[model samples]
Target: MIEEIDSMKNLQNEVGRNARLVGRILDRLREKGKLNEGVPLENGGLIKIELNHIANETVKEHFLEIANDNRILAVALNLFHEEQKKENPMPVILVSKDVIMRVKADTLGISSQDYLSDKIKNYDALYTGFITVFVHPSTIDSFYTEKHLPKSQVPELKETIDIYPNQFVIFKDSFGSNKSAVARYNKYTDSFEHLYSPESVWDVSPRNVQQRMAMDLLVNDSIPIVTLTGKSGTGKSLLALAWELSKVLDEKVYNKLLIARPIVPMGNDIGYLPGDKEEKLKPWMKPIYDNFEYIFRNRKTDTNIEDVIAGIKNIEIEALTYIRGRSIPKQFIIIDEAQNLTRHEIKTTISRVGESSKIVLLGDPEQIDNPYLDATSNGLTQVVEKFKESKLSGHVTLIKGERSKVAELAAKLL
Candidate 1:
């Protein structure tokens, strides 16, 4: 049974429009039932839907005491409490995406939990897109001399290493051995290919192996989707933007560079700052502009910020809101701060990618500001985990910070 409240206008609005996942689910239920309030499953089970009106005095009292300022939550809490009082009372647990709502349920002595259906277990064990494999010293030599080595030749590599497509492998001679080589697994050939030397993208060279792998994926035309996750100073955005600029301007791989981000606020809405759309986005997009400035400064010592901005004619910076209902083709699209988006939103954005377009999702999962999301449940991590095995997609988790010593220290110690 799915219980809801009539006072919850959000649910009512969704049901009325028949939009969003919830609304669509409810619509499916309506189609299966004569009264438009139930759904029959393939297992011969029925799910009855109930919408309760807020009228109980005890519920009103609870609302007055605990949720006087939030009517929707109060109504949901009232429904939960009512469900608990049934003759054959089943366990009533409130599942919510909002942390505060779950806290309020706890305060009301109600069982509550964050929605866990799409959440990943053991985020620490999440795919890093790379693994270390110890092999004989000759194996490293063979990789260097032949440019690639068949997986069957690496006898020391355990069968349980679970290498996925496009995953990077660090070949070491032995434990604490100095002889080492970095290679990417090619699933097609079932071999490990030698890593390309770090190449400059708009005069910005990768400072580490992780960044090198990231650049390889970013610039590769075969892999159309790339995800980069790391801490603030790890250069996720810088690398993505630099590669995007290189692709659009230098190589002419794509027609345009479309950069966007979810408009989630750290505290208050940007709408409160009193400015137009572009003006309001300035604060959010300042980091992207900073990357552009760095690239320009590196390319030309005397380049000014305005000169850099003016030179960029093939780039478009817009909110994610405008991306829907549009077919974005033949572009290098970069979605920054992607950790703030939900799985559904991510799917929608990705589905908008037209023919020959590449999309890069860059974010620090640890730095998500969206209240309803966490590192394990956010869209960025979802994409990383989902596409980890796909040949057309590649992901890199950047660890080394390139911003500065202070930034790196703060990311670590602070």
Candidate 2:
């Protein structure tokens, strides 16, 4: 990074914003700004390792044929392990996220593993905040008549099922009948209560069961932290934005609407920009503005489109760096594309919320851009699993893209 001395990362600008991968090593190097070119450490120095030759091309092709930087590192580690095995009574392991590095190290008799400290196990089975249970037809009837059913009435709850607070439940008759009801688990009452929120906002409504659950949670003032996760075009960001608009501009539930996202696409991680903060964020916030435009220009709201959209107030779309130390109170905050944030970044974002504020985290875990994170280890999935049982939090995993025919097909087939 310091080789050319051109337009690049500045240490002053990277504070609290850059990725944590090489920061520690860079800090150590920064102390000794100019290293002695010929000096070497007491124990060792950088040495070039050459590739081993073999007659078989096919076996060799699979074995370090690429000769990339990762392969070179793996070969070096293997060589060091082979030498140290005779002296030190310790295991030499290669810790990396690179698949080729791990596989090559394992094949060369060196222990290897992905960083496991923050990785969530069995991410495929991550909680969806919704489940379907088959019960007797009479139970569905009772739910319709009483508007609430005791947790004990559902025999499935007594078994291996462990439902979370604010979990949405779909009750279907075990028999062939079409009787069904959708209810949400009320942790305080120990019951499944019927959803009563007005489902329509600006002529936009949920098209699937999971979307309905997401709307229910979004409209509920009791649940301050909401998470919406799904594939692209599944309306994860749209739903949060819609509900935030209604709450902030219409109902005045919160003082302001602050929307922030990880600054990945702009540069590396919240890199330095030359203009004002808002100007620097305009390009990144186009999606948020587009959603607002779509909501205002819907088929049924053309008459009030200009008035409603132009008169909109108290909404801020900016980078997460600006929102770090501010006391954000009584605001409806949405963190878009939250999957790119690390666990520490997510924690810092959440900790900034003040009293009477609502924070909704929206993202598709499968679509992650951070090199150090995965679907399992990303902040979105981690927070969903960690807050599954919190009475103050709610989550819904939207399935099936409702954006368009081509969008749905691409989400599945592509």
Candidate 3:
């Protein structure tokens, strides 16, 4: 009983580029013998497909008067009214992702709801991958003295905390005590392990405890995937790039550093701009280049930005569009702005990770630009929630913004 308006023709035409799900729907329709020739099923129910025309001027005028800014919605309203006037009418609900369209439907006395099939419930209570627990001063002393403690020994931990695999914990010495230590819970060994304190990575040290936890997970060779969620200025991308370069250039742990980001625009598509692929991607990828330049400058290298870029034979930056159908192995892969991707896209991208490679997904859910996605529905959040308990994965939500004072203020106040 799916009804598509004629305005959807534009969407159908662009289906080849980014509508694999829509293409699946079309395939299902053809398999049911309902693509072009509407056929009746065994229960004497028939699927109908109709083209839109201006049969009722009154309905069209009313829709225009209500939804003048959206012609697609106007046409949809007209079709809904025409169907409502049928002899044996059924309940018709307009499902839409646009809030304004749903509001307009409500004004016109038509039923509407947000598209909720792919939405995650309880997104507000989503996992943060970190927790703070206060313990006795003696317990903290034992942790420092022994360097590790088994979960069975920490009786206080059971009262207030349910630790997940690889979850970071801040052990505070009661409420008013200033003594604190950071440790990661290892579910496999049932122990709290000490944090990795790297003096500096490319001259960039962790500015906060969360960032330290992020560094621990990022540099650990055993963990294959890590997800970092935070607002702008939280150094999610900066830390990822720093660790990636450190591993590839200094430690030689990975063969190459591969970075990819979805080409979703904040306003308009880059296709409308005039240029080929690389030229068009320059604006979108400028932040990556800026981080690279900062890292190179901190290294005290005697080379310009262009020369540094040209001399690096082990780094590759490309759009996420072409990453499908390829197996990426033994590389440090960073997917920046991962919140712009859907769950399907995230699964496909992660499946491409071959043996001995680590993938880091960095993005801010609040700063997503994709129209069809929200904070609770984006791929980054999905991955964080799904892999919260996996031994091979770790996640950290960076709260403090280290980019600058003004940037931090904007991220918080505005």
RMSD of 2: 7.2
Estimated TM-score for each candidate: 0.85, 0.78, 0.83
Tens digits of per-residue lDDT, candidate 2, 1-414, equal 222122333553333245343455555654544343222344674222134421233334446454443445545564564567686555655677777777876666677889787888888899999898999998999998998999998887798457899999998889978888999999999999998556578667888888888889988989999999998889887888888888987899998998888777733666676798666877787787778777766555544443454465687777886766788899999999999988878998999999999999999998888777789889889999999989999998998899898998988987
Q: Residue by residue across 134-176, what tens digits does model 1's lDDT show?
A: 8888899999999899988898765656788889988888756
Whole-model lDDT per candidate: 0.80, 0.78, 0.82
Residue 64 miss distance in model 2 (angstroms) = 11
Clashing pairs in 3: none
Least accurate 10 contiguous residues by lDDT in model 2: 46-55
Predicted structure 1, TM vs. truth: 0.85
The regions of model 3 sitting more than 4 angstroms off are 1-20, 26-58, 65-92, 159-162, 268-277
- Candidate 3 accuracy as TM-score: 0.83
Name the 10 consecutive residues with the lowest summed lDDT in model 3. Answer: 1-10
What lDDT does model 1 reach? 0.80
Local error of candidate 1 at residue 55 (angstroms): 6.7
